[model samples]
Target chain A: MPDTGTNDMTEILQTPLHDLHVELGAKMTPFAGYDMPLQYEGIMAEHNHTRQSAGLFDVSHMGQAHYTGDEAALEKLITADLAALKPGEQKYTLLLNDEGGIRDDLMVSRPFGEDGLYIVVNAATKAADFAHMASNTAGVGELRIIEDRALIALQGPAAADVFGALLPAAAEMVFMQCGVFDLEGVELYVSRSGYTGEDGYEISIPAANAEAVARKILGDDRAKPIGLGARDSLRLEAGLCLYGHDMDENRTPVEATLMWAIAKPRRERLDFPGAARVMQMFADKPARKRIGFTMSGAPAREGAEIVKDGKTIGVVTSGGFGPTIGGPVGMAYVDLEYAVADTEFEILLRGKARPAKVTKMPFVEHRFYRG
Target chain B: MSVKFTKDHEWVKVDGDEATVGITAYAADQLGDVVFVELPDVGKSFEPGDEMAVVESVKAASEVYAPVSGEVVAVNDVLEGEPQKVNESADGDGWFVKLKLSDKSQLDGLMDEAAYKAHIS
Candidate 1:
């Protein structure tokens, strides 16, 4: 049964934009300890609007923190090459468990002017991630959670233009570049990176100025407030993983097919957490690998079994109808042999097995503004 | 003449020996953006509580159950081409399947519009 997440409503947290969401007639749902907007106008409308123009999203519920000690020592916990990152550069990386499985996927940034590394993690795993960092990397660096900040992602083709209107400096930054901009007398740390495969910016602003800044952006007719529902579809269409759904603590980097994020330099040293076990995965390949699949018929949801020749070969981790694809799309883990692209299989949705094919990802082409 | 509702959120409108079945607007509001609808074949018969159809939204899929047992006479072919019609006109043109009522008394057992409204609230 899917978790409604509505059980303990009293204790759920609220972002600074909570009242703003309610004022805009957003459908609110409890997610990852916060009552977040599920939709604004509607998922379909917001999703299409983002693809065509720009969509402003309140992702303040996600965890934002900073590490303030030895940078190389802190690098021992993440899979990415943090040491080589120039100031103002961001790296997408994974937090690995001792067993080589992914605890959470996150972004590490060497923010301009900041003496330490800036990190953003999944909302659901933030508590655990922080705890792990505090205990394991104790003498190396101090992890300080930035609870007073609010994170907003302005994504899609028009994102740069929107930010350009507010802060011209941010608009000039290339993808993965971070800079702190003064917006309406408040400091906003803007990064040219996002989960959606779009030319966008993720701005970390103070909680006080979030509503005012969000209002200023939405005041522009080119952008609208998008909710979590459309955000999920956009990310899924971009072939990005939703930490708990697409991957979890049980999935290793090799199994998740995220070798691209493991920088080449890090491969030589292999000094990160679970490097020994992760090396074992490199020596002897993972039996199963995650693949993007085209789902027809009834859309295969998470937990649906993937079957081939009357045998269950894999399971879908994240599956849903892709509005852009005009069909169902999913990410699943299957036996390495069956992981080949174009390989056909049947996904058992409910009690019925429906035809599906292993396909390449980015159901939609990533339009990240690469410089 | 009048519409009846099931606890599962499907509605049926009976006239003569045939009944038009579709999900209620409340259900559609709950589901949010119906991307696809899977209706049973025309000649198929279903029993009350049987899962006869499937409705998929962007994020989740739901099974539309039969509120009353009957043989399907027709289905909304428009839905096959444009499923969003269910979201556009959920109760009107969005009607799922027309069924030949197997048991007329089943309608009396279901909730009336007033009762459904009160049930939802």
Candidate 2:
């Protein structure tokens, strides 16, 4: 289970759309130091709604910042080749600790004609992430945290149709492309990328105008307000990793099955933080590899032990029902020998070993718009 | 027949020494979209507060505790295929098990419909 940390109600923070969420009858829960909506109508309903239509998600709790000055300064800290990241393009990258462990996974984008990079990090680790970036790049670049902005994602197959109606220019951009757009006088940084495995956009608007813009998009009949519950399910089906749950400070990118995020040029240079260790893992292959699996019976949630022939091989990191697939799906890190697809294993749930089998990821095919 | 409720959200409907058990509508609503259920075996005995079954939602798993000491007379096998019955007809066709009461006195301590409603409210 994802750690829904126990937060003192008095100190919990609220996003800009807190009132709007409550107005929509969202069940509020504390997540990442913010009092966020856990669900609206319900998880299943919201999950299906997003798959069939467009869903709006308030992700303002995520950290957004502007990295100005030297691109090399920023590249040194992450795995992505920032120099190759053209204007109006975005890349999913990871911030690695000196030991090659993933500190956080983030999106680094360069808005059209912009001088600096627009970065968004996970909410839970934003403070530490910012501090790391600031302290590391002090002499070369400036890491300006964007606290006055609110981020929201409009996702799903119908997202393009609903969003295109508002801004025709933005709708034309393909996946991973981003640009600044004017939405009825509101200056918004819109990225044609999202966590859900659908063609969508992540829009960053000034905190003050967030509600107005969100309400405008939600005004469309095809779009519904989604909460964290469905957001989690959508990403899980997409085979996307949740920052804290899937990869953490102790897990390296190779072990987490995210080596593709490391740009080839960076790999050739072995210049990013812990590049030597990461490359060595690439050559030797990590002892444990993350794999996706499908299982029957109760969902094998995080902390469930993965067993093969009565011996503990690994453990589940993320697991839940994949609404799209109509069954239980999850990810786990198991001994490399037991990570092959179709390999049968047992997931110990409540002391009972339940049958499970390794399966290919993105249990649902990704429908990214690449045009 | 007298229907009694547990604070844990289980409902027990007694017909003589035998009783039918299921979750209340309130409990079903709280556990959105029942995807799977693991039923206790028939003939198995459980004391009050013991885990009788496991109900899984799309998001998490919740344990259904035994409301009173009883021996499971029959398990709801239909739930294995159509667990959503718990969400659709939580008090009717969604019954999880029929139990032969091991201790009838345990039902007296449970809340009646009126008190259950008050407790939830």
Please state the Cα-based DockQ of model 1 relative to the true two-chain complex.
Answer: 0.79
* Model 2 bad stretches (over 4 Å): A1-10
Across A1-371, the per-residue lDDT of candidate 2 in tens digits comes to 34758654568899999999999999999899998999999998898898899999999999999989988877889999988999999999999999999999999999947689999999999999999999988898999999999999999899999999999998799999999999889999999999889889999999999999899899999999999999999999999999888889899999999999999999999998899998899899999999999988788999899998889999999999988999999999999999999999999999999999999999999998999
Task: Estimate, for each residue in A31-127, the C-alpha lDDT of model 1 and write its tens digit.
Answer: 9989999998889889999999999999999999988887776677788887678788998999888787889999998875658888999999999
- Candidate 1 clashing pairs? none
User: Could you give candidate 2's per-residue lDDT for residues B24-102 as a string of tens digits?
Assistant: 9999998989999999988899999999999999879999999999999998899999999999999999999999998
Q: How high is the CA lDDT of each candidate model?
A: 0.89, 0.93
Superposition error at A39 for model 1 (Å)? 0.4
What does the lDDT come to for candidate 2? 0.93
User: Chain A TM-score of each model, in the order shown?
Assistant: 0.96, 0.97
TM-score of chain B of each: 0.98, 0.98
